[model samples]
Target: MRREGSKAFYIHTFGCQMNQADSAIITSLLQREGYHPAENENDAGIILLNTCAVRENAVDRIEHYLQHLQGMKKRDKGLIVGVAGCVPQFQREEMFTMSPAIDFLAGPDTYRTLPLVIEQARAGIRLASLEFNAAETYEGIDPVREGLISAVVPVMRGCNNMCAFCVVPFTRGRERSHPFKSVIVEVQKLVASGYREITLIGQNVNSYSDPEDGHNFADLLDAVSSEAPMARIRFTTSHPKDISEALVRTIAERRNICNHIHLPVQSGSSRMLDLMNRGHTIEEYREKIALIRSVIPGVALSTDIIAGFCGEQEEDHQATLELLSAVRFDSAFMFFYSERPGTLAARTLEDDIPEAVKKRRLQEIIDLQNSISDKHYQDTVGTVVEVLAESESRRSSEQLMGRTDTNRVVVFEREHYQAGDRLNVLISSATSATLIGRPEHGVVQH
Candidate 1:
């Protein structure tokens, strides 16, 4: 179980919340086998890259990082280099050929077998574990918490929907919910450990269902809130078509559930939507948003928007802009589309959108969202909302930063406040992306 005389490993994660949750599981597994977490790559015996392949830019960054790790390996021969998560799942043995410095490669489903792989790597064996496992949830594995403020707990894995631009279905495989009891147990543990927030993560969290236990996402949310009434509960990346009224109702009923939802609507035109195989039309997505707002009044909404796709036209871009004006999301994650390798789009469609056009469209989306976000922030000025203190403000040490239940960042003057305290903040100033506040007289309880 020992990696030479050293037992430290550092995992650098890329991609989404699912990958972050996977990194936590890997940390716990390695610790159980006597591996300590290294502070940095140079301090570690093993340097693990938990990669992403959703966009080509992320893959490019990984390739650059690999070169740095390889240079470090040349100076220190004892360092064990490895790659995990989505990138390795797709690239597999090709990654080994590309980066000979890597000693081990483990896929998202193959993390549990990593200890054996580490042993093989110790014996100078280059190893790769890229096979998919239908029933592996890392069920009994308890993730080691790195911080006490907030934690990402994965309730499920994989994706069943094959969005033409998506690489998740191929990398993470079909959807599978973890055992319901195990999920509740982890929530209880996090609450007991003084964590203030928990975001249930998955490729598409709305699809969580366990037929044997007769439990769905709504049931799980109820159980978690019932188990840890003081912890702020949240979940992310809900599929537009699958988001239910029951889920929205559950949030309304619970005082601790965050009043925010991130439902990604990649395109606004029906033609473009069908081309991407998103499984939901613009009208249907509009209905889901309407339902969510009806159930939970004043709930902050956010979305993901792609500027260019395989055959995106000027009319399609105009349609997307119109949708932005209509929805007026509090915030958005926007990207100029990049077709991923091994995806349906890559195999069947041509990436014919000119780069200049994609960039222009993306900038337009950004400008529009910025205006909407500014209006939302200005509206919040003079309102008093609860904020869980997360850390010192990056802009100023004299201030502390936290988030409102709506998941908006609010920075306020630090006055006898700590990292975990919940404060009633009086919103005083507004920016496009942040709200500046001051602590009010009364405390806000979770």
Candidate 2:
């Protein structure tokens, strides 16, 4: 499969862990066809943008990069550019017209045919495959590159919960879980490859139910933990209504599962919740959090919150602030609502939230989260925590950065340690976002 010239490719990934996993698959496909990975876009023969359509800002960033690539193509004249993921799925003809430099457009499911499409593009043909499929799964392909300590494995594709503001149901199609045996096989392979942590990924992870054998998400978690040799397990983007008692109990019993949950409470006001069609009220979210804490003591909780929606009033905004204060999450990913076309919200609701008000409310949410995060980290001072070394610190060469089982960042000065070592760190200082620590003892070599 080797080509004549030194064909190299670079992928710029944007958005959630699901997008990350798709990029990995695309990378694997390119490598299998004898393309080397380029360190940067300027030096590559091919460039691919794996895009996200969740936020308008993300779309803007991709367009900016496409403009830069267009200029680069004028200089090189041989660069083959492609667009993949949700943006291409949502905007096929528009994306091609928006950037004439783009040579191929492939969606999430069309990744298996990417090598062929790349060949076609090289032969002066524009290719696009945005069709959705419920039966396609790339479970057997080995990723060309993987992180040393952690990796994300997507166990399902698409979403069934049509949250009014979300375009995922439209862009990604219906929900389909990968076979349980296939998922376990992937986890086992990852463990054997020296990956210590694995995060099961999906658009709605908790809603994953095996149609073949009736094994639900909780059942899959228990099965994977029991069979796989990995040290830690985590999952993301859980819907509030889908969080079950059995899942909480399983987390409490499993010693290897990480004690962190990323349940997204988009808004706090009951009216706003109903408007968004999120299928759960604020009280239900609180009850779910309480159940998790009661079953698994000291569990770390994080969330996603939207500050302003179409018709959010001062009272609704206040409710969001109060929810933040009450939850006191370890961290949160906050954003101002941006309506996307083809979504329920865009079709039904008016985009009436003023930009200035949205910005003010978003800033207030950020400020409150900063205080809560600072308090949480400060309380961890002088406590010993286990950390998996991820990489060298960005600021200092003498320091190594890693994350605890609860996903808190720890920066420590340690010599003779590489990226994958698991070490015990004694916290010396704390900030809102990171903890400064030193090795409690000698670094534990893997």
Candidate 3:
């Protein structure tokens, strides 16, 4: 039977993978309340923007999108428009003033109240809530995982670190880990449902420790991987300071754990690291990188880099560039330092670097990383790697696309192969962004 709904909703999401996971839970919440998803905003009875406030421009972008929604509301006076996630998680009152079109608001921790908020909004009551639940990790909520082949399971919520430039501590509240058994149960269900991949997500995944049993991050990872040995296990957003050798060894030893880690080195200069309170030094990060390489010889390394941070000098930018060249990271997510309201950087330091300087530094970082990535991709040619077939290649129907354990996109000939099939493919050629390959042995397992 239908979970809910002749009524429909449209969840427009922004920000990180964590936000994507949150949006999924919100979908489940609305579905359980008897609402279905609309094909688009025009068809939906409600429009909710799962927002981000990591950068000032992200908020600007959401506000700009809200302007268009005003016309949608004009067509249906009863249409509910709401804002959720980190953008309003800490600034709910400001959000109410930012856009008159919004009829309601919610925070990262207050999604359980969404149905009631909607009901009240429809009755001519505009309300907003940002109640932080000490234990809310949306555990009881069964999320719509979007598909069966891969699922995102949030094992923890919030962060304890108050990085000088970050708003996460303020927006997401204090660090709290989810119950270990609940996480294990969730992963077991996904595997039973034919999920071949599970990505354990969190604000700081390495910091996760079970609330009841006192199991640490590595313990949880071991449990999940043991439960589903054939499934590709992956995790995200590891802070450098918390990355343990045990975690690195687990990735090396576990047959299922994908050998890719997202270690964010916001800046390579120790001076900047101290200012950001990232809790690690450049030399220490380099040592960790060395340890990771020693353990997982072929690990694909990715990272996040911020350019022109507060009080950044030309030398600091040079230092970042030098690290990019030295590490030769396979890929990176690069951004210009944008002061978020309520963050330490905004309250105390200057966004002292000129906008032009930030842009220049960011572009230089991108160009360097791309060249390095090209070099790395070229070196992988002729290697036989196993990739889990995912979808029809966007370029052609005759080609199938999937990702290597290192997380590189590999496109291969589609010869009776189907999605979820793992195939051994030999790299034939490379583009700047993708690797083209041919299947070594067709249809190994689907």
Single out the weakest 10-residue window by summed lDDT for candidate 3: 1-10
**lDDT at position 235, candidate 2:** 89
Q: Model 2: per-residue lDDT, tens digit, 297-328?
A: 98999998898898899999899999989989
Error of 1 at 425 (Å): 0.9
Instruction: Give all TM-scores, in the order shown.
Output: 0.97, 0.96, 0.96
TM-score of 3: 0.96
Collision pairs in model 2: none
lDDT tens readout by residue for model 3, 220-254: 89889999887999998788988998888888889
Q: Give the number of the best model, judged by TM-score.
A: 1
- Candidate 1 lDDT over residue span 1-446, tens digit each: 22454788999999877888889899999989988899887778988999999988889999999998888877887888889999989987898876778899999999988888988898999989999998988999998767789998898899999999999999999899988889988888888888889999888998899746969898988888888888888899899988888988999999889999999998889999999999988999999998998999989999999998989999999999999999889999999998788899999999999999999999999999999999999999999989999999998889999999899999998988878889899999999989998999756764
TM value for model 2: 0.96
How are the candidates ranked when ordered by lDDT, highest leading?
1, 3, 2
Kindly report which residue pairs in candidate 1 clash with one another: none
- Tally clashes: model 3: 2
lDDT of 3: 0.88
Candidate 1 segments whose C-alpha is farther than 4 A from its true place: 1-5
Q: What is the lDDT of residue 64 in candidate 3?
A: 94
Model 2, 175: alpha-carbon shift in Å? 1.0
Q: Give the alpha-carbon lDDT of every model.
A: 0.90, 0.87, 0.88
